[model samples]
Target: MAKVKLKKLTKKFKEVLAVGNISLDIEDGEFLTLVGPSGCGKSTTLRLIAGLENPTQGDIYIDGQKVNDLPPQKRNVSMVFQSYALFPHMSVESNLAFGLKIKKKSAREKQEKIRWAIDLLGLSGFEKRLPKELSGGERQRVALGRALVLEPKVLLLDEPLSNLDAKLRLRMRTELKRLHKKIKTTIIYVTHDQAEAMTLSDRLAVMRDGKILQVGTPEEIYQKPKDVFCAGFIGSPPMNFISGEKVPQVKDKNIMVGIRPEHLSVSLTKIAQAIPGKTSVTETLGSDNYLYVDISDQLISVRLKPDERIPEDKSVWLFPHQGKLHLFDKTTGKRI
Candidate 1:
């Protein structure tokens, strides 16, 4: 229920700059995700907001109040880490009631809150179960419920679903989206999984080397990436890049042309304006097939329907869809 803001926030670990100067504004009740590769400072940024780590420079504001000098307990923020830090020996209800007990809430108040959390998280039958008795997903919910019982003004999650199996992770994603809608609390999430970030965030801040490369909605970043790294990173199959000089349609030699796998079509025969290549491999993933074509020693992937099949080592041609090409500077890798 609060808006968070960062002004030139920075953190340095002696010789290493963990988080470079960066500014961001998270709207009230909005879910914002920071996504990037490992060591990209996404986790560091989340820790700064949670008061788990102090920033080297700049300020953090929550609900328009400067919180850079405040301790984590006084900041009204709750964080869930990659590992579900649940109390191993405690029952689910006890885990949920621990924070309320620390704050010395009345017995009735604690019971009411614990019941609410259990019901909210769909754990009605598992209240007496310990962490060891619960499934991975159930245990994760206990950790989340423990955080929620405190009614924090802001919730921070750092790769909270990374430990779950793929199917369980998908289910958790759906649960998180539903939870956000019901509570409307401001959430700042950090993860390296682009698919997870895209599924859960209202806005995404793509980071690289301790700096934010771009910030936008999932569709915005996917359809119109501002730079080469973003263009290559956000998609499942990822966008394919080719030297502009190798493309007959491109006039600039000092640039690179990017076409997503879905934006390129595979053809066995040469066509008008087609780029010739030899088929390298094909990957069938239930609903869709991905064809890899080697063009001038560079492999380009093309999306195909599940029914479509192309032989390996077969000569093929590629045709880019109109208006789908992305242009970037060869030297700087910036969008052109």
Candidate 2:
């Protein structure tokens, strides 16, 4: 395993700056994920680290060695793309042995390495099957096995689970976590799915428009977001933002108040010092129901239990939990 570092890394394609000046340090054997919306430069950053794309400026260091001019093969890293990219013509064993063959390892060495990969990925029974014969999850495991056979010091995964179905994606995520725990290889993962980023990463970097907005543990970022954009981007239903002037007891009228759906409770009866709103909609998702309350021109979402019932008149009051209100400056859109 090896530690990776980026110093003022930047990449530009003519007028488009796909990745701006960004610096980060990834510890050896750590699973770090870069997450954000589409076209947010997370993929560009991953490619730069994998030696697939040349940076416009700054330097990359792997295992304390500068490798700005090194090719992908010399970086001792393996990348698994979103597409499985398996060889339809070759069997699973052959696909796993392809890279070793190019490296010109002995026949016995190749066989041993292939066996190790197959066992590690739980693919012993499917070694002779072609890509067409395997399910999506099996094919994904084959792709991962192909990379693992090389024993790379670092692994780069770019939305590897995006192509699978929802249930399959969840299963693959669990397998990935287990694999990381067993091998402890340094992994740099890129994905736009917040659920994947939160569940898989030891630490996550939130990016936007070619720049990193915030980097922290999932809990830290969700609980105390530094900026309005990050606060709204990291949550499931996202945070509810209200103009400070419209809410009672707000000391700063020129600010915005942010409260997560779980932080606000709906009261059926009118109460003093509570914000009044009309129940606009309710969404039922298994165990929890999300209630959307319209407060004048703004809409607020509140999390409710499945058993909770709304009033027939559609009248409700919003009560923000104490010490849960997030205050942001209106002009700067920054937490205050």
Candidate 3:
């Protein structure tokens, strides 16, 4: 296992600065995920760490040693790419042994490592199968095995489960979590799927337009986002926001009022639990429902639990929990 530290890391492509002045610390044996939307530079960041791309500036350190100048092999990090990147003609066992072979390990050592990885990834019966013969999830596991058999210090996974079916992806994610726990190696995974990131990571680094927006545990990122972008990005259905002018009694200064849908309430009768508003739309989701309400010129979402009497669309009172409301500075979008 290794601790990785990225300091003032910058990457540029022509005129575009893809990752700028980014600094992060990944603890030894920790599972860290980088998650963002497309073109948000997550994959690029992982590439830099793997020595697949040269940094324009700054440094990358692993186990207290600077590695920006080190080649991928010299840096001793293994990468599992999004595409799986397995050789179509090579058997799983052959692919798993390819890396060890390059390092010139003895025949006995290579075979032992390959056997261990194949069994560990539950691919024993599929050892002789070529990449094309395997399912997408199976191929992904093979890719992981290829990387793991090398037993490098840091493991980098770039949306490794993106190609699988939904159910397979979910199953693979649980397996990956278990694998990480068992190996206890430093892992850096990159993905655009927020749910995957939330479920797999010990901590997450949220990126936007080449900048680090916020870095925190899933709970911190969800419950106390640093900015409006992050608050909206981390949650399912996102967070509901409303613009409000200064009212010392309600809150201070101009703020972007945020209330998680679950934090707001809707009722047919006036309720003292939250502020009053009118329902504009009621969406039923089987288990629960959402009531979009207009409050002081703002739209707020209130979640309704099972079998609650659906309120009339004409007018329904909205109550936002005072303690649950988040205030962000209007101009900078940062939490205030």
What is the TM-score of each predicted model, taking all chains together?
0.98, 0.97, 0.93
lDDT of 2 by residue, 293-319 (tens): 989968788999668967534889998
User: lDDT per residue, candidate 3, 174-255, as tens digits?
Assistant: 9999999999989999999999999999999999998889999999999999999999999876798776542222554578
All models: lDDT? Answer: 0.93, 0.91, 0.87
Q: Which stretches of candidate 2 lie over 4 Å from their true place?
A: 311-313
TM-score of 1: 0.98
Best by lDDT: 1
TM-score of 3: 0.93
In order of lDDT, best first, we have: 1, 2, 3
* Per-residue C-alpha lDDT of model 1 across residues 1-336, encoded as one tens digit per residue: 899999999999998998999999999999999999999999899999999999999999999999999999999999999876888899999999988887767899899999999999999999999999999999999989988989999999999999899999999999999999999999999999999999999999999999999999999999999999999989989999999988878957899999999999888887878889999989888888899999988999999966788999998999999999999999999998
